[model samples]
Every structure is written in structure tokens, then in C-alpha cells.
Target: MPEEVIFESESDRSREEIAAYLRTVADNLESGEGITLKSDGDSLSLDPPTHSTFEVKAEREGPEGGPKELSVEFELEWPEDGETESESGELEIE
Candidate 1:
């Protein structure tokens, strides 16, 4: 499937700032609310269904033994036309 970019923004931020943003999203999700993103007059709203796929990934990019970049990504995916979620093993983080 072709991927489409809706709204995106990236910038340097403190750990507390990042955590606050994540907490806001988590709160809305728990209360069954849609997420609305607004930046520079561009806005996007996303309302994920109850049953969706959640993915957590930890990755290291860049050349080996050189300057490396590490990242952790959290994603939620669900079918727009039809509902489907794949199963996976349990994930634990320390």
C-alpha cells in the first residue's frame, strides 16, 4: 500500500517535554477522544478504533562503529476499509 504523509513535525526537545506530549495522547485515547494535530495552520485529526495494531520498535541507524542514531518508535495501525490486527509475541521494556 502506498503511504501518505499527512502532518509531520520534528524538533529537539527535552525528555519531560516529550513525555508530556505522549501523556496528552494517552489521556485522550483512554477517554475515547480523537487526536487533533495543528501546526502552522495545518491540521489533521485521527480517531483510532478500539481494536487496532500497536507496534513498538527500537532501532539503531547509521554506520557501524561510527556515528550512530538510536530511536524508539510507537505506532498504531488499523485498516481504514476493514478492521484487522496481527498478533505478535509479548514485548517487555526495562
Candidate 2:
């Protein structure tokens, strides 16, 4: 499926700063509030359903003889109808 680009912002940040941002998002999710992401003059508000698809991915990309770049991504996906099936699993982060 084709995707539309929304408000986007990315830059290098300290680990402490990144943790702070993630904490804010976690708080909002726990409170069942829409998340508003703003960067410069662009902004987007997303109201995820109570049950949504949560995904976590980790990847490494690099040339055969070069250094590798590692990245971890977290995402939440839900349909416009706000219907989703809940899944149970064990995830340990550390």
C-alpha cells in the first residue's frame, strides 16, 4: 500500500534526550490521548485505537568492508475503523 508523508523530523540526539521523548509518548499512550507530533511548522495528530498493532524491528546496514549502522524502530498501526486483534507475547528489552 502507498503511504502518505506526514510531519517528520529527525536528527542526532543524546540518549537522555531520546529517553525523555519516549517517556512523553509513553505517558500519553497510557492516558489514552492522541499524540501530536510537531516539527518546525508541520504537525500531525494521531489517535490510535485502544487495540493496535505494535511492531519492533532492529536492523544493521553497511557495506561488506565498512562499518555497520544499527537501528531500532517502534511502530503502532491500526485501521481507520479502529478494529484490531490483540496479541500476547513476551518481549524483554535490555
Candidate 3:
């Protein structure tokens, strides 16, 4: 299947700043409200179903003997029609 990005942002930010963004997302999810993303001239609002598949990944990219890049990503996925089913799994983050 092909994938399209509705909204995206990349930048350097302080830990505190990153926490703020994450908190906003968490709040919206908890409230069962639409999440809105806005940039200079781009904006989108999306509603996530009550339950969805959540994925977390930690990865490293770079050639051997070269500087390595590291990243952690969090994702939530659901159908466009706002329906979702979850697989069995347990996760914990520190």
C-alpha cells in the first residue's frame, strides 16, 4: 500500500519543548478530541479512534566506522473511517 503524509515537522528542540508538544497530544487524546497540527501555512485536524495500534521504535542509522544517527519514534495508527482493532501486547517506557 502507498502512504501519504498529511503533516510533518522536523527540527532541533530542547527536551522541555519536545515534552510540551507530547503533552499537548496526550491531552487531546485523553479528551477524545481532534488533534490539530499547524505550521507556517499548513494545517490539519485529525480524529483518532478510541483504540489504535501504537508503535514505538528506536533505531540507529549510519555506515560502520562513520558517525551514527539515533532516533526514537512514536506512532498511532487507525483506519480513515475511525475504526481500529488492537493486537495483544504490553509496553512500558521509562
Candidate 4:
């Protein structure tokens, strides 16, 4: 499926800064409120269903004989209609 870019931001930040950003998102999710992302002139708001799909990924991208770039990504996805069904499972993050 084709995707449209919304508010996008990429920058080098300290671990504490990154954690603070994630905490903001977590707090919003706990409150069952929509998320509003704003960066400079770009802004977007998304209301995810309660049972959206949550995904975590780790990746390494590089050439065969070059330095490798490592990344970890967290994603939440759901249909546009705001209906979702998900199974519960144990997740441990540390």
C-alpha cells in the first residue's frame, strides 16, 4: 500500500532526550488520547484504536565491508476506520 508522510523528524539526541520523548507518547497512550506530532511547520494528529498492532524491530544496514548502522524502531498501526482487534501477550522490556 502507498503511504503518505506525515510529521517526520530525525536528529541525533541524547538518550535522556529520547527517553523523554518516548515517555510523552506513553503518557498520551495511557490517557487514551490522540497523539499530535508537530515539528516546525509540519503537524499531524492521529487517533489510534485501543487495539492497534504494535511492532518492534531491530535492523542493521551496511555494505559487506563497511561500517554497519544499527537501528531499533517501534511502531503502532491500525486501520483508518479506528476499529482494531488484537490478542494479548506478555511483553517484557528492559
Off by over 4 Å in 2: none
Residue 48 accuracy (lDDT) in model 4: 80
Report the C-alpha lDDT of model 3 over 12-89, residue by residue, as the tens digit: 999999999999999999999989999888999988888988999999999999999999999999988867776879
Which stretches of candidate 3 lie above 4 Å from their native place? Answer: none
lDDT of each: 0.86, 0.90, 0.92, 0.88
Ranking by lDDT: 3, 2, 4, 1
Lowest-sum lDDT 10-residue window in model 1: 80-89
Candidate 2 worst ten-residue window by lDDT: 80-89
Which numbered prediction scores highest in lDDT against the true structure?
A: 3
Clashing pairs in 2: none
Model 1 clashing residue pairs (backbone): none
| Predicted structure 2: clash tally | 0
Taking the tens digit of each residue's C-alpha lDDT, what string does model 1 give over 1-94? 7899888988899999999989999999899998898878899998888767888989999987899998999998888776566576698867
Listed in order, each prediction's TM-score against the native is 0.86, 0.91, 0.93, 0.91
Give the best candidate by TM-score.
3
For model 2, how does the per-residue alpha-carbon lDDT over 45-76 read when each residue is reduced to its tens digit? 99988888888999999999999999999988
Candidate 3 displacement at residue 1 in angstroms: 1.3
lDDT of 4 by residue, 1-94 (tens): 8899766899899999999989999999999988988887888998888888888888999999999999999999898877778778676779
- In candidate 2, position 91 carries an lDDT of 82
Q: What is the lDDT of residue 34 in candidate 4?
A: 86
